[model samples]
Target chain A: MATELPSNIKSSDVLTDQTSSKWLPPGLALQKVDERIMTLNVGPQHPGSGHMRLIVQIDGDYIVACDPDPGYVHRGEEKMAEYRNYITNIPHLERPVIHDSCNVLYPYVLGVEELLGIEVPERAKYVRVIASELNRCIYIMYWLAIYGIFLGHSTMFMWPAGDRELLIDLMEKMTGARVTHAHFVPGGVRNDLPPNFEEVCLRQVAYFEKRIKEYAAVFYDNPILIARTQDTGVLSRQDAIRLGTTGSVLRASGVDYDLRQKEPYDVYEELDIHSNVMKEGDSYARSKIPWLDMMESCNIIRQALQKMPKSGSVRVKLKPNPKGKGLNTVYKRVESGRGSLGCYIVSDGKPEPYRVKLSVPSFRNLIALPYLLKGEKLGNMPSVYWSLNYWPVEADR
Target chain B: MIGTATGIIRALNSGIKHLAIKRFTLRYPEEKLKFVGDGYQFDPSTGVGIAGLKGRHLLFHDHCTGCQLCSIACEGVAEAIAMVKVPEEHKQNKKAIMPQIDYGKCVFCGLCVDACPFYALYMTNDYELSSFSKEGLIYTPAQLQVKPYVAQDSEIIITSRGATHG
Candidate 1:
């Protein structure tokens, strides 16, 4: 249906000055007209916003423009890495996205190993895959929980948050920490798995898979959510690629690009990974893809556990204060929970790195926010925004 | 109207089903998690630290040589470990300087445990180190020597209904 403007309305009338005469000079008189539009700053302190603000301009119920203002939680992680030595940087480097610490540190570990010319053991690769997949579900559950509350579904928030502990419990048993595992390192993982880890992991993950399937009835397939989200902030295939969006935002628009399948890292090439894609490219599709990916993650974890060698070392013995080859640089990218997280390192043959740069997916995916939000209803702001899977701290860092 | 009604009912049904399921939260302070090993320890022979939670640092006064390796290792990371002058006299610790860890700044990454060539520094499962004062949190060399008492027996049990940490 085409929206036709009233014949009596003129283009200049829509842009009429509304300032009072007291605020302007005597010679310049302000026009008196009824105000139909208002600006809303939803941000920084709002529960719906994750440390960033959205400058929204709404005309009646429709939003005219939405500008995403980021960089509220920036701590300059890349700058801090230059001062610390290779081994010491791990703890602080994973702080940007603590819940998804393994994946955030994956590309950094890969790049550092490349610079040091260390070959990881076969068992370590399989262990890394399991840990990465587990961390993926943990991070996604947290995101989904917030996505639920943003859409006024309180039960959706509670269930995902509760079930996420199953994965976090397994992570704690395996890597020692609940969220910030700091498990991945330059040569390999920090330590080997605990005894009877396989059985415990298998049991918890199987239950977790069962729990996530129940979300389909409650959150994903609900008619109210579909009405509020579907066709509201639609992004076509051309715009998604043209805007340089990554992860679920890109995949929701019928793009079948998943870095795990395309540029396979570690044991990803050995394992079978099915990239979840949807053609709708609305808020619903963006939200549904992550749930599909969580199921795929469970499948990948089961495959990794069955194929993993029974007994072997998880960490390679690295010399104290290990340094890279002189004046060399390396860039590595890994498929993280948010999207493709890449790390670029330039080593100067010293213990400390020369420079480090992170190409975070949250910042990349945020580019499409303003594009999708324009001309959308004001009520659909939270549904459209949170569905993009934007992590503020990671993006700002 | 039928589709909407069923959708709401289905969602409510899922929520109601979980009400019969047990809670997954661990009642902390009263109940701590049981770890697999005693603590995270490094063997010089293997050159790899064993798998465990990186918690409070436990210093072995007898094994410490006042080497300052752990303090040096923590410089770029947390700067929580400091080499301070000690009054006691020992053959190994000739310098009379021992490492004092301030828990305020520690990230508990356990890099210091890996840096100790001698089996002097290791991590224990005692994570409950909360204190009233800032000075109380700074564990001295003598304080680190004493082992912490921790009682943890909780584990996640999966049942026909659901999973719970008990």
Candidate 2:
């Protein structure tokens, strides 16, 4: 049986009532609340929210509250890592952020090397830095493409996507695959750079930098984009720090902390690393920081290529079925594309790790979503939500 | 007002400038992209790998000793490699067993190649492995031994205007 709408209830009111007896079976109805307040599910399937749901409660045009529901794309990556040995875990561990696979694996590799007591070669260190920087650009470009599409800018999407291929091509030459580059192993990289790789890398990186610079004219400088995102969903510095936001979210909030600069893992200490910090904690600044970081990545790749040893072994060969020491634990963190990605490993003299935990930036940055989207307009949802640089798979993993 | 107008104009100008640049895509069926080398190969002595595309795998019948290292390596990751009995007789491979890779499940991680100490298994640039049936996806020892033909000839060429596959 169907029920007619009451005289007082508007057409939009039908959607707001989740416990209406009209749709549900009899006796399933719950108590009703204020009529003006509406609940919006911004997708486990919506274009704006990719593979995650945002339970948004709105009053008129303003958002009263927004709850980010991650784990729709969760694959139990941490549990899977415990079953497999260290070497076998490489393929699946990088699955969370495959576009930036090198950085995602960086922390895990460092932690494993610590447990195994293997000293990485100097050439390998430089090579790892270069790969990490290249992967960072690849990831930022992919993120920028999605961010552009979220803000209804198709041209912004196309330019970053097409320009991204330049780095992807270089990556395909370095590592076999374009995206899921299981290139980083425990000791060092799986393979050394191909012959003539330096010249090709230098040429492509120069062009890629030039290409990304042009994005400012189209995306960041566009009047429409500036107006839509400039002051909306501002995360204050104090709130950001208190909430413990990482990566670009923290950097955009005027907290000048970069793991590569502060911690200096691998060869970051030797290189001139410049952290991009912005005073404006709005969506615009949060989105622009990654772009600036990409420019910095280009410089890093050039420097690493120059300083890399002329000829040496990239990987320290280990015995088959390598096992970590008994009663050992190591924690390692690196600056991934999204933010500071940390890996915690516990070994008990077994081929398989006793415990593996990945503290991903996407999940850490997600804590700021409800805080940022609290009083933002419904129209500003996409820009504000995406500018936090939250990747759903990484967050859920 | 002037700043807004100028910003709009600059965005428009940049978009228009890209119109003159060449399209950055390959006509896939007619033109295939070229690869750097024969395939991804590892030297057990050097303990380092050579860079190449990780497509379908190539198994050397003469080199493989039925050690089952590739199968063991792939068990945790994809379970794509399975040891199968071979009819062909070889002096090195006394057990007459070799790896049969199911392409449908293979993640192309190249761990199997790295695991093979005898230089028996290596990945080739032949990535195109589509078939009508799932059964056709699994390549047997005999099938893996044969080198598939690849027609790839295109590579990315950067110019003053832009980069394009040429």
lDDT of 2 by residue, B1-166 (tens): 9999999999999999989998787789999988889889999998999999999999999999999999999999999999999998999989999999999999999999999999999999998999999999999999999987888888889899788998
Runs in model 1 deviating more than 4 A are: A1-35, A46-50
TM-score of chain B of 1: 0.95
Question: Please, what are the lDDT tens digits per residue for candidate 1 over residues A1-397?
Answer: 1223355676566543455412544213332333786778887664543488887878898988787888888899999999999999999899999889999999999999999999999899999999999999999999999999989888888888999988888887777778787788887887888889999999999999998998888888888888888997798999999988889888999999999999999989999899999999999999999999999999999999999998887788898899999999999999999888999999999989999999999999888988899888888988998889888889988
Q: How well does candidate 2 match the true structure in TM-score terms? A: 0.94
Q: Give the winner by TM-score.
A: 2
Give the per-residue lDDT of model 2 (tens digit) for A92-194. 9999988899999999999999999999999899989999999999999988999999898999888889889899999999998989999999888999999
Clashes of each: 0, 0
Candidate whose DockQ is highest:
2
| TM-scores, one per candidate | 0.92, 0.94
